[model samples]
Target: MCRWAADLGDAIFLEDVIAAPSHSLIAQSSHAREAKSPTNADGFGVAWYGDRPEPGLYRDILPAWSDSNLRSLGRQIKSGLFLAHVRASTGGATSRLNCHPFTSGRWSFMHNGQIGGFEKIRRRLENALSDDLFDQLEGATDSELLFRLMIGEGLSSDPYGAVSRVTSRVIEASRVAGIEPSLKLTAAFSDGEALHAVRYATDDHAPTLYTAAFAKRAGRCVVSEPFDRDGRIWREIPQSSFVTMTRDGTSIRPFAPATTRWALAS
Candidate 1:
């Protein structure tokens, strides 16, 4: 699994979350406290929205802790919304193309879990994407595919429902292939105006996720774990839940697959 941090708040330097905290994303790259694996050294990526229609992205195959360039860039860039990820590949080659914070137009996404038997279901998932979405894909990771699949399923109109439909498809496909449904997904994404995150799995063993609401600002942060050990500052998101953070505030609610058995059986 991987570790990631997403901040949707005041326009501050990216380094505040990516490298400044005592247990920042850069620190998690070397010694993660909550992931199944301790070292997420395969690569790292950061994305933040700016004045352009699309978000700016910086990704590399170097481990976050070892990359001085990342530290320098983090200190310089400022944005109201930023996402940073440290990867520990369960599948796919260790390349920049395989890094996190995958982007499409104004949307950026990052994931902290793996789909069970992704290799078996990769073709099925790819075939389900629209031609336009398929063309947008530049990497071979299931994480990126999930993002495009959500877009094909109407993410721009209904972000939460689109993700539910995509996860339902992954679960159903794994079952048909005789693979144990072990889809551990805790993902965060943004469409420039708002951020959406989900902590869910086929079973109860979802990867860890947390969120912190700023006391003074109308903003919230979604992260794999609290950057610091302040229980008062962060709330561990419940299993099988969804979160949305916007300029107004933050909201949390239960989440379930939207696809019905009739639809799957048909």
Candidate 2:
């Protein structure tokens, strides 16, 4: 899994989520305490909305800590909405295209965790995509394929529902292929207006996923783990839940499972 962070305001400030003291994302790249693997040196990427109408992206096949360019860029850039990721490849080439913060039009997406049984079910998943989305599938990672599926499924209007449907389809397809798919997914997506995030797992015990909210009015910063004990308000997002934030405020909602039983049964 990768680490990422996004800030939304007059502009977006998205960067690789790597500001924590000890177990920060940068730290995890070297000595991960929770991941199945201890090192995430495959690559890193970041995207943030800038003064232009479109967001800016910076990606490289270099470890986050070792990349001086990213360090210099991080200090120089600031936006109201931004995204950053450090990758651990799951069968894709370690290249810039395979990095996170994949962008399409005004939308940007970054995912943590993997799609279980991806290789077995890749063809089935691809066949389900629309021509337009299929044409745009650039890299071969399960994450990119999943994003295209969401786009082809018309998820722009209702992102939450779209993601749930896509996940359900992948899981059902994997089952048909005689693979017990166990997905661990936590994602953040934005269309330059609102940001949506979800934490979910196919098995009950999914990979560790958490979210923290920071309120300027309340003068608090919440995170996956406590960054500081400055006596600010911070809380963990419940498992199998989704959160959406806009200019007004943030709202939490339950993740409604998709009705893919028939699809699986077929």
Candidate 3:
């Protein structure tokens, strides 16, 4: 969706994918078939990349469905590359800062799923981040923390490698805490050029991630569930896989974390 043809010659609107779809992000907020929390009423956020390197961000502690601005803005704003998230609290306080699609410089990220016992190891994970990344942190959610950790793990240069390293560390920490030792997640991140996503877990299930091409338009969309009623069009990413989407096309490959211990630079 990074082509210059924003909204693909005006056939698709932002809301058309976020709010209007049958199993849209708004619908998944209420009864997600694969999410840990069915009710994503804690908060919502959207990050859209425009001409600038950094993406524009909007977040509020309201369910996406209840947010009038979200609807209004979605209808008006047009972007080829954007990400919207409806959050269901999973061991984090409900607040604007705790929302998804956390931003750092030009990078934007959003996630679905949870760490088995985030509370027990949150501090450890936080401690691993460098001072600069720690200073940018404003929320206590594991999703934001993971973004920063990915940054610390070298997201700017090695996006998927960073994610894999961080996931390995988190799962190792959870095991030490006598928790489930699982890091179940489906996440997407971008640096305003191409979008990268991963679906990985130490458990039996990984949160669902799917992508569908526009029928009448010239864009692609990735979602937690099928964006439209016709599930046949959406292709689910395989478990433990990495996907990279660009103006050229999308590519998928097997994904897994680095088993080596992760130690951030001081």
Candidate 4:
């Protein structure tokens, strides 16, 4: 997995910090200090909301550390909502269509981590998708499958519910395939108006996920990890939780498992 960030404010300040700091996303790609595998150089992507209602996306099969176009674009474009991702392919092909921050209609999504044993249950999962959504599939990645599943489950209206429902279905599919699913997933989705994120895992212990706020300090920013050691307000998001942010404020809530009926219906 690779580090990613999203920011929503008066203007977009999104960048693939993969190469910015001393221990940036780019550093993580080739020499990750946290994961067993130390490389995440498969591909990278970004999405940002501009004047239009829909978000704009940029994806490349190039390593973030070597992408000059990304560096140039990151410095020039600005928006109020944005998402960035650095990928290390688990079971997916190395293609731009399989990149994160996938967009459809007016929504955008990005994911971190993998769906363990995805190959075992991929057929089952695919069978459950509606023809309309199934036909739209452009890549063969579990992340993209999860996104489509959420959409088929009605994410446009209730994002939290859709995610929970899909999670439950995936878990069930894994069980039937005689394999326990290990899902270490941190995700963010937005519809140009509201932003939502979830940090979850099938195991009792999940991966690192954090959130922070400016507090009363002006011109300050919050992120996954502090830019520096100034941790006056940076806080870790609790395990198995979801967050929602808008112009008004941010909300933290428990992420409950979806009902059996809800999962099968969708």
lDDT by residue (tens digit), candidate 4, 1-266: 65566666567445423345565555666666655466778898888888788888899999887889988887788677787777878777899998887988898887877789988888889988999889988888898899999999899999999999999888888777778777877788889887888888888666566665553332222234433334335567888999898877788899965867423322
Off by over 4 Å in 2: 10-24, 215-232, 260-266
Off by over 4 Å in 3: 1-12, 178-180, 230-232, 262-266
Model 1, position 83: C-alpha lDDT score: 88
**Tens digits of per-residue lDDT for model 3 on 109-164?**
88887787788888888888789989999988788899989999999999888998
The top-ranked prediction according to lDDT is 1
Model 1 poorest 10 in a row by lDDT = 257-266
Which candidate achieves the best TM-score against the true structure?
1
230, model 4: CA deviation in Å?
Answer: 4.8
Better of 1 and 3 by TM-score: 1
Please give, for residues 1-266, the per-residue lDDT of candidate 1 as tens digits.
Answer: 89999998789889988998899999999999988899999999999998897999999999999999999999899999988899999989999999999998889999999898999878878888778888999888999999999999889999999999898888887777778877888999998889999999887989999988776655679999888764338888999999999888889999988764322321
TM-score ranking, best first: 1, 3, 4, 2
Over 150-248, each residue of candidate 2 has an lDDT whose tens digit, in order, gives: 787666888988899888888788879998977877788888778788878888654554445444331111132333334334466777888887767
Give the Å shift of residue 147 in candidate 3. 0.5
Higher-TM-score candidate of 2 and 4: 4
Per-candidate local distance difference test: 0.89, 0.72, 0.77, 0.75
What's each prediction's TM-score?
0.95, 0.87, 0.90, 0.89
Per-residue error at 212 for model 3, in Å?
1.3
